[model samples]
Target: MFSHHGHGHGQYQPPATGPQHEPTFKIFCRADEGYCLTVRHDAVHWYKDMRHSTRVKDEEGHPAFALVNRATGLAVKHSLGQSHPVKLVPYNPEYQDESVLWTESKDVGHGFRCIRMVNNIYLNLDAFHGDKSHGGVHDGTTVVLWEWCKGDNQCWKILPWGPEAYAPPPPPAYGHQAYPPPPPNREPGHGYHPAPAFYPPQPPPSHDEPGYGYHPPPGGPPGAGYGNRLPRALASEPTVRILCRADEAYSLTVRNGAVCLAPTNPRDDFQHWVKDMRHSTSIKDEEGYPAFALVNKATGEAIKHSLGQSHPVRLVPYNPEYLDESVLWTESKDVGHGFRCVRMVNNIYLNFDAFHGDKDHGGVHDGTTVVLWEWCKGDNQRWKILPWFCFWRDEYCSGLILYYSTMRCSRPLPPALLPPPLPLPPLAAKAVEVVPKRSERIAAKMALEALEGPIHAVSRAQRNLMRKLGLVPERGPVTAEAIAAYNALFSKPLSQEHIIALSSLFSGSLPPGKAAEALVVCG
Candidate 1:
């Protein structure tokens, strides 16, 4: 359940568990198409307002931002750079400070909101009347601070930095491949099954059930009568995309309580379908040709034909004993290059012609109005099946993950994420010294200004982040509340001696680089 009380703060569980060592990831803002969460020159606040790169490293050659302090329930940012301070900040290592941390706050299904843990405020992106015409990003747009309101800008998608998050490369040539007919003993002859009762009693949906929303008519897994002998060969293919002869990609995507042809992209995991021969329900047509149900990877639902009205085809929870004739189709080489045809139960060809407008995303057909048409050997009538390959030991290539692209590892499991037997190796030395030229100087000034306040505590590294951001203000105009705010953020309180040393170092207006080194030993 979600709560709308107390400024609309809500609780949410992350979609996936993060790695143990707090791997760096790129946080993308959903409101904008391709902007990334980036730190400003001040290094005090962040905004999802920068164009991101797809290279292995950022333009500055640094790993992206990492999620840290997982146990604290606060998302602290950390850069992977060796010289970077142990504080939460974006990928820019030039400026380091007490690092800003945020909490998930709420999960609104499509996206989630982030609340800055430091000041209990929500991160927001300025929406220009809901039209992002050079809005609150770094393009001279205004990024203002606001209380927690759960606006669109606050919602984000934090994805790991690696190939897993990337779009698929160019597709392979469209090659048509068909599953071999089941061994003899499969009785021949096919006739349409009787129409099922209208809106048959439906079981309430459950998260526990594999395919809850979709179910086959007469309901159940395929081949209920077929013994539980698992076929070893059928599960051999791994990740793949099915191509149509028309040169467009065809996939069994979620449609009105079933699977139908929807638009596909390299990142679509649902595009990966499976064939379970051992338990697959095979039906032989009058000509003795065999067809099997195309099963979904996430849910075991198999493509089935519904006898209701339009003779619609849908994905139903598999049930072997149901003896459903609509769910079966025979694959034959159609009179076209690189394409095969699917013969539906009525001897009509399966077609996606009528509902072509909404091809990019998926939607239900016109309730069987144009589900099937006479076989015309058109683009919509042809189909192709691609097989998945195994990663390690190419032997036993079976099953592609329904939600991820390619079988390759997104990234190697970090040493800390592994078991105790494999300890985290010490970090190697940096081959180059990438210092913050201007931001660090400015950031150091900011840290000093905050230290001069009543709280009177500052760290050597914290000042380094502000070094180039700007020069320090003269030792005046510091307030008690500002000092208290700075003090409250420090995990380790600075001692009296350390405060006196920082004050003296600032009084002289010493060189930024040497001043940081002096404070290192003051404590």
Candidate 2:
């Protein structure tokens, strides 16, 4: 057995002495917390979850070895196509991707061991404790990265849970193959007839609201789109840096006559670019492929890569004439993180290439230049156009209050928050008391359980029937109380104004004051 040492976490390398077998051992941190390092089903990254007993094992209760890759000597990784902190996952026989290799390190220090993955990144939880920063203290929170220093959450113990405790592996297929040959198709116009294609049944409509039954078009508040994009959708959403393929946050700003890309701060205002499709130079590109301006909210300018000019692209005031072919840029394909912004004038793509003192007056040494170059699928060539939702940028309100007032009632709550609707029959709508109060109470319970449509409609039907019999109430409070009073007269309907008081009585929309009366008729 050989061991390699002295390297830091991100720079450590396993000794290249052919393939190595990582002994099967259960990992533990705080035994009392009962969390062991467990792998996701995808076999990418290991998280702080899984009990100590639930590790990889074979039949006959024997532990399984973590086969380290001969080339890299690292274990499972979370990030495949993207760059991220390396983490561990269980080894999968099929699809054996790049991260199926790992090596157990000798006690690094502080009487603890480390599990290093293929990319030389150690399985580190020193920076975080699976706490609120990562959705509160629980199992399966992200195991982060750090330089190798065994202390606190970074230190771990590999306790051997004997083979006797290992669970037996499931039996593998012996005779049947997964991809069996398809059934032979019959010749057209032959003696055989083909069967119709079978489709699965669909689920029932959602019934989380009053009018969500199989009738009345399942009424409730209109869809969010009905609000005229009041806290608008993603296209009208807030602007973000949209970190590029290079993993570097690029700041978009104009200095010395051209737009430049520099390293950005956390929330850099200079990097915020709004994609405005309202004005397009060509009518041909209006449909899905609309030409637009990358408007900077901070400076109130647009990126102008002057057509045919050798000079770097500069940010200038939006001119309706110049917006013809020069300023408008078309969005190409989505490049994973962002889109490729192609200059409409010359058909060339915009890029943030390193400025090596090109003698352009608008160039910066450390910063990147906005040059119009051929698209090569490079990281710097992609630009993310973030959306802005605040009223300062556009005249749109958050509509947060409106949403809560309208939809909050629909959610489930404790019994105290929503009292049962009062019991009252349509006959009670008149001053004459014929039905006994006990019978009305039993009828009310049944009515409440059955009614499932708009309260206003049910109320109207009741009032119309009462009017025909000439049994309308005299003046104030009908049926002795406010609920019955409101129920007697369907003509008086509750509006949005009564939401606050009604919000306490029901879970869906503000139930009409006479909603209880409507239920009796509906039942």
Candidate 3:
């Protein structure tokens, strides 16, 4: 018999008695009769019908074990702070960190043990809306770290891992025809035994019911309530915004060729980046984390490190054939809540230099330049990467209904069906009002020429002009190989736009024919 009066602290027992092997087990919450702990899409949740087996491996010279999940092949880990939700992460045996290791307390009652961290906080099923009065053993309720209160929700019953534990029992046997005959080679009670009549077959819980398996995060979806969103892992070439964890308002932005921390502006093209798909075939860091070039949406340049402490990070033209290591980066060392360190080659990390002096002078404010610094385990170095679409969805159609309407309709929509116009910032609004004059366009072209300065100065502009004229296919990046391909296919005469663009490039110093020759030579 179990008593509920005491603190419930009992003698600790190893999950497995065997010395040479670790046994897999299922953790069933005592508060929820049939519900067992499982991981779905790397998020910890309780499921009655579906559950993953977990094995405990003894840590050398430590009392705890690394709780590894079979589904994701990851270890159950949690942040250091109390009341944080437990997460699944890649296990590193070389560095057996405390976050990935968990200890088992003595059985409180009926073989239910308290799984706790070394810090004394027990693994707890989160209460409904954080209300302690309501037992949060409902299906899909997240598991979090909390101080032990001797509640049944904190006590878990470890059973031998098997599908039969959660699988529905066979229908009550009526006659001999209900089950197949036993195997001929087996003994009388050896194999293919029919299910007991006393065990009733209960219907699985209906997932369609409200509050059954759908527990949306508080305050809705990450940014602007985009509705049910796909996980980052499922998205191929997801556009992202690198936001500094120290100051949520600031994000990694390309300004005047240098990469720095700037106030997050959703409308700014410089802030949005796409993971380069060209390097997708070979995009893993040293630690096996996904790595790629952060290609800017507006400039078509990739973020690159110049390879020294004194050099500030800059954006360079993106070329897949160059095989540049400086352009590659990876997100590693999860700090919590989708934040991690953006690490470059040679162990250099992206750091927000906020610390100035003892007194608070200038720290993490707007326009703070980001630099490549050594790992200091500071919060300034951790960054939260968010999908760019979350912040920029105002200008585009979102949600299934909107997508259906846009795809199905051919004519103009009714007033009620029309999407509301997106609000533009003051600068964007002002720029949209002005019409560009020919002189202004020429002056802009002149400015670009001055910036490039005589070293393949007109190559980019010419390539753009060729793309516009259909001289080159708009499929991939304009690299040296693309130029050679275009030259081989060059048979059509130059268009008027080409002559005009060429004249602008040379201040009309060369004739039309001479400029056309020069363009081919440049190619």
Candidate 4:
């Protein structure tokens, strides 16, 4: 039989037999500091100082415990499947539900332990499609069961539950000593005084004080530096370059007004693109994917899709509003290894056609033209988005050191040493009012049919509505097979009243007659 240990000793022992009678504890995932595992709205989430009970073990003789949230009184449950997410359910006092059981392993370091399910999958902080720049731990990130790979995101710390868990740790002792021997005395009525040359000298006055806070340097903003200025200056709008996944050495570059794949070069500004934050915010698509323009550093031109398959991408003058759809693209689908499919209008994607010549045998090489192509899930379609400085590390390391040094010193460089300021993009224009025309809509439908093959005109509207409701694939043509799949998913179709109610909720002003037509088509 196993024994239990008290709090603060960082030791927890589960009961070897019989029902659990141990004290409750807080569970904290090592992936995010200071946040503990909690149940919110029937879902396992990360929050501050939530308590859980882990005394009960599985009746089937497997070494596991039922994690029940103290606040919600719900037990954490993970279905015996890979696709299901971990959730919180009403506690069963009899302990009959086996899915509520979990097994905690030995400490993995820093008092964090891996909690595994009976299916051999571990409770993990979901970061499957996380951004590479950050660790990907954010507010409300879901908890899921994933195959164990020994990652810190899968390790959790068990802490004693109580008011003591919420108490802050004692601050470090500095001992008896005046902090900086007091700042040197200055002349009367003089508010500013120079600090000493030693490390971490007296800090400047706060922004509220007269003559303090961050003031723009003579040449540019606070963070801007000379020499290698692009990366440091545009910190708000990060500088990133697109690298072809099929050929890692080749990057998307603008050469002679056309987009092409060329060998990665640090000095070549054509390969560097700034992800336009302003346009991304204003011109996002209906699906919530941010459609941003990739602006080339050297030419100040944006990569524009010319519309239609096999059409060469061109570098056009930047349009802040993204009034033209050709200049907008979205990175919605992750394709592994920090790469994603850069999707354009409809189902077209940015592709490096390595098989352009000799369709059966051509291979990816330098100078290959980048063009628009229908989605085929090929490696040539995946592109890695990386910071421009990452590609020019060898050349900009010294500039980075100088930048950090200035940041530490808290002194602005002399005006003579500063580089010329870069021009900022014009503010986005007011959104253009769109007047829908039947002729234009028909033309667009015809274009889509040419690319993806034709669908029946009779049920087109119903199929499109079902696609929006996630009953069918959004990009493909509505075929008989697709209709059958939709029917299989929904055995009982909604009535005319239900369709009208849904339409009113979504569009608020959709006519009832149109909603009734939708129901008939759905039937």
Candidate 5:
């Protein structure tokens, strides 16, 4: 038995065989959510975060996040009960999603980024599996070190810190460990269990364990005088932003007795900096008139030296053409975001079903063209997708993804997100079918009478679905079937929205998740 020597504060470990250095791990990852897993004891532990429940069917805290060891189909998820560590034996890997974003690399100096939007709080690569926004960057950039990217193996192994690192994670009270005070009367043969009487005596907390009930991150600046304010017990985690000044690579961690780096000069790029008139710090310009000035904290004056000679202020880019398409359409303003023009569509904008020469870049008007590039704004290139799809759907609501096959390869739209909400919906029913307004009743009558036009594939699918859903009687033309189906579908005077949700069967641009909402259940 041993204890710390003098003031050295060294941890004395007796001989037992498990890896010595403690490590950190991420347990769960989702794009919109932040923290998923943290290293506690020798094992990784997980707890549900608010952002996660919105994306998946989280039944309870029971199954916090999925973990699996490749060699075994199921890996036991180890947890801490009130006292001892309890192991929930083997869980299926297929049901659980796992990614070794940071591998145990041999590359010592190599850096790793925290996937904030998905896993940790620094960098995010991919949010959705099926969508284009896989990583923060689209051109196949792995934002962090992963085994898949074929980088040096060291990319995965991140060294937590130096010798004087954050204090060690609390020791696990294994099932075999004994409690304090031994026992009131030690029966010669029997040992103590974690019963009410055998509760392990807790050691007095050290300076590392903030005795004050304070959230350290928000507890003003580090080393600030919190002399009066202290928590009964410090936070279990204290987040630190780690940055490699050499590589500008960064990772953030809740320094929970684990050594991680610190962040560098972090700045928000959305601010505008205007110059001053005299160029002296003394002559200040109050820039909060039309917009607030991004000023230096030391001097509450204009950002640049002087204003006279064309001080290029950094204002947020308002280029409608450069903005995300959905945002542009909603705000009805062109922030000069990018939009590509195709000769086929003779326009610059995106449309999943927009028929054209199907080509790009100055092709002839054969409407059978090829070649596509990123969209940008020119009059010929000035574009926006129609915000309303057939009046009943949320247009462009991640509708950019089209599972189209020019050959056998399905081309997915870039910067698109995966089909969230599970099993992407089948295309909405009935909505795609062109319907005559009440004013066009005569036209509808004429169309029914003619019956000469080629039926579109979507329209045909609508007919089939209607028949399948028992909306129409068997063995009849689509118009007749439609009439019967419409009568059966509604009791109230249904609007187009209600009719489509109830009777839609068209297989066009439906988001995969809404397949059930748009389902036309067949007989």
Candidate 6:
């Protein structure tokens, strides 16, 4: 049975889970607050998406992991400590599907963008299609946007100990296959299609903002950082480097007359640096080539920079508490990554009693940068933190106002240090399309239920009408499926009243069939 010790890949090994003390290493610490946690890892390095570090998605759009609750910030803890095995919380139904990257071409499911990459290099931008050929699929194969980036599929970091040293956790449903095979009968097309007249799906709207089809983002407030996004780079990029060779132009030596010293120092030749897959902290790939400068020091939020306007600043080492990893979720939810220790007039933290101004008055916009600083504890000093909605808890704001706000709203608050509760405009200009609201869903459900009776009646009427028209199916005792076929084939006027009238009109018919397959639409 082994035990956890030391740090990094070498020293961080957990016990066999039989009976051992697993060395505990802090993957992340939100100053003092904490929340949902997984088995800790000893070497989990996160990189920004644009940095071309993780192939999964740009760090801007997709974060490696996230923490919520009393601690509110966006930054990934790149584990450099040792490994320790830990048991996964059984049936963690609370598991959230965070966005790993942005869909340059299309959306996956929910609001998650669909795409793939190899290493940290860009490859193909595509949408996930179940079976049909929407873009350029063949064999009815489903295709999602995929770039040839490395480590894209390496979703989890596995760490197991001897018998008990629980540290780095295992994936859900441990000791079993995570992804089961598709149903045997289900064909692999754009999406599983039972029969004709049914296509898999349409590209989901990029942003769920009312009716604004699908905008690729940069479509919102300036600084609400969108982490881990994978956008394509323009072509015609140079592939060359200059080498320094202490050369004394040989061609000019003879013409000079005077004895000129020929180039004698050994020369160094520079070659084109190409992007490659290399695990690292802050910077995505450090082995082959780096999109941004490498981390001189990999401290917890000590390394990296945000890619500002040009490329934002290099991603500072992320601290999940301050920033979000998912680009779509962050943008939709409106958040940023990394927190700078702000200097203050009082030159201190944890002393909010004297806190006057705002905690984080300066907004954390899409490309905003924050370094630790000091400020007076007032509206100017108090900053609105996120994921944590406590008035002063850990500064995690989710659109809810503080308990003492004059407006007095008890829901989630958004954007820190708001002077007053001003109604924020809709996220989109046109109309932000969203899933049917609760009330709309309820209404739709009622409408669906109401259709049941009429549908039954309509089936009977249809059978009678078919008999009158002499086009009824040979099968007796018509089934709902059969009725559906009939309805679809005939295209009669469809309304609840019409269906009931038809049913009553043909009540004397032979066998009464059912209506269309039970539609389970909420609305």
Best candidate (score: TM-score): 4
TM-scores vs. true structure, each candidate: 0.29, 0.26, 0.30, 0.31, 0.19, 0.15
Better of 1 and 5 by lDDT: 1
> How displaced is residue 499 in candidate 5, in Å?
23
**lDDT tens string, model 4, 61-145?**
2355566653345666553233335665555444233345566676678887777653233333333322234555555555766
RMSD of 2: 27.2
- Per-residue alpha-carbon lDDT of candidate 6 for residues 369-428, written as tens digits (9 for 90 to 100): 222222232322122111101112223222221322212223324646444533322211
In candidate 2, what residue range of length 10 has the lowest lDDT sum? 1-10
For each candidate in the order shown, give its overall lDDT on alpha carbons: 0.35, 0.36, 0.46, 0.47, 0.23, 0.22
User: Residues 299-324, candidate 5, lDDT per residue (tens digit)?
Assistant: 11111111111111111111111111
Residues 1-523, model 3: lDDT tens digits: 1111111111212223432124455566677655556664211211111111132222211145556553334666543223546665554343324445566676689888777653223344332232346745555666776667777777776565443323333453466222233245633211112322211112223342211233333554544322222223322455677776566656676665567777766556567777664554555654666656777655456666432233355555555554554467777867763467776632333432323311244457666666655566666767766664341143232332233223233443576765565443332233234422222211111011111112122234445544543444575333222332343333234334443445544465655445545665643
How would you order the candidates by lDDT, starting with the best? Answer: 4, 3, 2, 1, 5, 6
Error of 2 at 379 (Å): 1.8
Candidate 4 has what TM-score? 0.31
Candidate 3 all-Cα RMSD:
22.8
Query: For candidate 4, what is the lDDT?
Result: 0.47
Model 2 clashes, total count: 13
Q: Report the C-alpha lDDT of model 2 over 1-523, residue by residue, as the tens digit.
A: 1011111112112222422222233454531134544443211111121222234221222222343221122333422211123443333333212223333455656556554432223333332443334443354544554446544455566564343222332332587333222235622112112211210111223343111121222356555322121112223534534323332334555444346666544234455566666554442232235666665544445665432213355554443333233356666667652345454422323343333323333323335666554555555555554432222222121122122112223343455644344333333332123323322221220011112121221233233333222233333111111222233333233233222222322333434435433333433
lDDT of 4 at 358: 22
In model 3, the number of clashes is: 0
After superposition, candidate 3 runs with Cα above 4 Å error: 1-238, 280-283, 348-361, 390-523
Higher-lDDT candidate among 1 and 3? Answer: 3
Kindly provide the TM-score of model 2 when superposed on the true structure, using C-alpha atoms.
0.26
